[model samples]
Target: MTARRSMIRRAAAVAAAATAAVVLAACGGGNDSSAGHEGHGKSPSPSASAPASASASAKQGEHNAADVSFAKGMIPHHRQAVEMAELAETRAGSAEVKKLAAEIKKAQGPEIKTLSGWLTSWGEAVPTEEESGEHAGHSMSGMMTPEEMDKLQKSSGKAFDTAFLQMMVKHHEGAIEMAKTEQSNGAYRPARDMARAIITSQSAEIERMNKLFGKS
Candidate 1:
């Protein structure tokens, strides 16, 4: 009886040892799996996120000098166009001229703001009204001389309509020229897109004005 009890106790001890071994192995595997997951998670986050942020920053700041020049030049160009359009409200006789003038103001007013915003974001100077007047005398194309502006301001009715249409056609041509340059040389996407838009819209307006001249 004593021998039998000792053998039974020994068998129970062997079973417990086997069970403990399995549990320890399972614990060690779980720890290894958890550690592996943590390592994988940590490795990808910084590397993956870093490139994404850098790419975004690169895209945001992606602009060349041509883009800057486009924005700087277009701001005042648009401002002057708006100024001419405003004169048409009071001076123009033709209903068609008034409507076209309104459209020019509507289109160019927002563009002036957009160009100014782009310049501001690029840390460039926005053209002031005074600066715009100064630029009108020299570098910018299609800008009316002070005498011409004075004439437009003084004239009314059919005379004003003729002058306005003639001047606007010339102005749009100049804007189209500038826009083409931007399309060719500018690096910023938004600025390039604006250039394309300017080309399309102003070209159409020029064609319309030419037709109006034919009618006159």
Candidate 2:
């Protein structure tokens, strides 16, 4: 009887050990599955987020007629400024004037391209100098007339420097006016942002020029 009871106890111990091992395996498998599901639920995939960001950027590019006008008008305006800046290389006497002209060219040259791109994207016609001639009588503010441009091209040394500064000061003021209109009326973010930058930077340049030329 003593031996039989000992054998029964040993069998019961073996059965309990097997049952515990089975329970532990099942619990570990369930925990792993839960962790996988939690990870999947926590964050979006990179591929999914990229398209959303792109769509938002596209929406920002969408523009209105005011935005279109701002771009169309600014293109030629910038082009003419670049033209004036080019003359500074040969005509300006002051190092400061030459530097300012170069800065204007650098800033506006790419801006002309950007404005043209915006017009094209909006399905509007980009204006050329010839095409822009229809508005010759009512030229955009601060534009140099043919006579004024001729005068600038004719002058050199101090005469060129003085004329360039005066013309550019007027030119920058016109840009600020246009920028204000864009700020108040335009819908495209990039165009409006450019307008604001033009206002700020050109305003500072205007002040610098005034101080340089002894003009209030």
Candidate 3:
């Protein structure tokens, strides 16, 4: 019962994260459909508008320059982790597995927002890296491949629990790698701190997951 509860909680958090991110991104982070125009008036002459546009563009460009590297790199990075968490929520039967998923979702969701906030402040598009390819079965730390996700999607009971634990272990490790990279190369201090914290917590979680899966 506890395990089920935990898994449910984690699932909720992951769903919330995905939902919130899409909402926030839609609202402001990525596309500014209104950027070039103002209320149904004749378009400002480029001669007059050029400087404003250029300035806005320049600010956005700088924001991208300053923040893009973090958002671009982190978005995909967090996405994979979220995917892994989602898998754990559905398949994991153990309280530990569910708890891990919740932790992952909680952590990454905020990080996603932090990065999104950066882009919003900078007035730039959300980095586009995560959208480039199919995420269906791509593997990371312990993230299942397509086959693996397929298996989990089909399995039930203990089978799901074991697989979830094993896969999440690997997925978390992958996340650790990305986090380390950000810690070293990410432009923003907060982003870098997020990377470091992910590494620390996930590394600890990896050990726990290993024990749960008897991989220890």
Candidate 4:
């Protein structure tokens, strides 16, 4: 859970700049881009909401199945990850935890917007559901539960750090799985590249997390 949140938050942080001008609703007859929703401070979108829309869009072009699935599946997955990263920043006592949280938030923010835009342009449902679990649980790569998140948020100091690394490692692995699935099954150029990037980067992070967790 922690890892997933971190990833999404990171996505947002990166895309923060690009997301300012959103043209939602125009995607598939949805509500239209409200620009972070009137005063609520741009709530983080779960992965479930964006995929359906993305899938519809991906189908239109030379884009392959992997691209659609990657966007559809990953958008909700990234939402959970961003949430987790925020929890860490607020609850964690360690500087490392804070820094990591900042990184996650930075990276995920824009990805969320980018994927949403993709889905909108594609004219799909956005892969989101009314209930959060629509994601089919963390069974997919880079996903975590609210309960698991509670565990991470409750820890502190060394324990918090350890749990964070362990959880993030698993989270990154999940992302890798999703990415691999994209690479094998997806067809879009940019989407495929993103998948490969996730594979290359998270693999290293996974190793680092392991070493950190193993430390006595």
Clashes of each: 0, 0, 6, 50
lDDT of 3 by residue, 88-160 (tens): 6766667777787788888888788787787778677775544523562353333446676677778755787
> Candidate 1 on 49-101: residue-level lDDT in tens?
98889988898658989999888888878888899999989888888888999
Which pairs of residues collide in candidate 2?
Answer: none
Instruction: Indicate whether candidate 2 or candidate 3 has the larger TM-score.
Output: 2
Quick one: ranking by lDDT, best first?
Answer: 1, 2, 4, 3
**Between candidates 1 and 3, which one is better according to TM-score?**
1
Question: What is the lDDT for 141 in model 4?
Answer: 61
* RMSD to truth, every model: 5.5, 7.3, 34.9, 33.9
Cα error, residue 196 of model 2, in Å, equals 0.6
- Where in model 2 is the C-alpha error above 4 Å? 1-60, 132-137
Candidate 1's clash total is 0
Model 2 earns a TM-score of 0.70
Cα lDDT of model 4 by residue, 112-206, tens digit: 78877777776766866432353445556656776777788787777777777777777778888998988888777778887888788778767
CA lDDT of every candidate: 0.88, 0.87, 0.69, 0.71
TM-score order of candidates, best first? 1, 2, 4, 3
TM-score attained by model 4: 0.64
Better of 2 and 4 by lDDT: 2
TM-score of each: 0.74, 0.70, 0.57, 0.64
